[model samples]
Target: MNDMLRQIEPLIPALRRYARTLLRDRAGADDLVQDCLERAVNHWSQRRDDNPRAWIFTILHNLAITRLRSSASRPRHIAIDDAQEETFARAPSQEDGLRYRELLEAVARLPEDQKSVLLLATVEGLSYAETAGVLGVPIGTVMSRLSRARERLLKERDGDRGAQPVAQLRRVK
Candidate 1:
């Protein structure tokens, strides 16, 4: 019990980083991380020998999927703080800031599956097998999704923002 807690403690920063990347909203990311921690602590005894990082990540991923899937069915209220002061260490140059913002927008625009696969494998530094375990997909599928995600981000960064996104085709026979 204490061992599990100690192990999970070190993962807090990594979990928060992954959650923030997965969810752009700060409050939502914090909520997700909190929920993941709760679940981990609750199931610690049952999962004593398993990989704690993977277990927590899987829980977090599942929770995010459920919320994202149901979001359209519910109305969400967002509170904006108009007077919030922005703070940063060594603020980036204007061009750098613009590029960073563009990268975020591109990642946000990716399909949910591709985005998850990319963020988990790259940003979270998870192996293909580990990402597959988290997402409950085959390793090959994870690889394909990650590859596609990288390609899409590259295309978006190179192309004009005003260009229309390619549409998926549906066949009606």
Candidate 2:
């Protein structure tokens, strides 16, 4: 058990990073990582010594997927702070913040599966094979989804209703 904790200790940062990317919020991501580590600690004694890293990763992946699925069934809405919104609205540089807002909205528009793959690959810096393992998909599928994700992001950012005109042009062009 002590050896298992020692082995799993190094995975905490990686787990937190992956969780943050998956959840897109610091508090939610930390909760997810905490949940994952708790599960890992509870199950560590039963784990085989062959590949602990893969085992922990699999647990985290499963938890994130399950939560995402659950969240999908609900209506999507951002819980913006009214006060902050009002303050920002009154700010002189509101235009700059609008671009940030638009980009975030575009990201929110992505399909969950594509977002997951993109986050796993880019934010987590997982290799193709590693992402495939985490996503339980073929490497080819990972590549295809990643390509599609990039394409969709470009389209969203470039559409007329997207962010500021100059920023959209810079992104699309």
Winning candidate number (TM-score): 1
**Candidate 1: where are CA atoms >4 Å away?**
80-93, 160-173
lDDT accuracy of residue 34 in candidate 1: 98
Instruction: Return the lDDT, model 2, position 62.
Output: 92
Clashes of 2: 0
Residue by residue across 29-134, what tens digits does model 2's lDDT show?
7888899899988887776655577577778989988887898799656566523355445534777887877766676678877877887787666788877887
lDDT of 1 by residue, 37-146 (tens): 99888877766345778778898888887877787688876645522244224556799897997898899899999999998888888899889988989999999999
TM-scores for all candidates: the values are 0.81, 0.66
Candidate 2: where is the Cα deviation over 4 Å? 1-7, 45-54, 71-101, 161-173
Query: What is the lDDT for 67 in model 1?
Result: 71
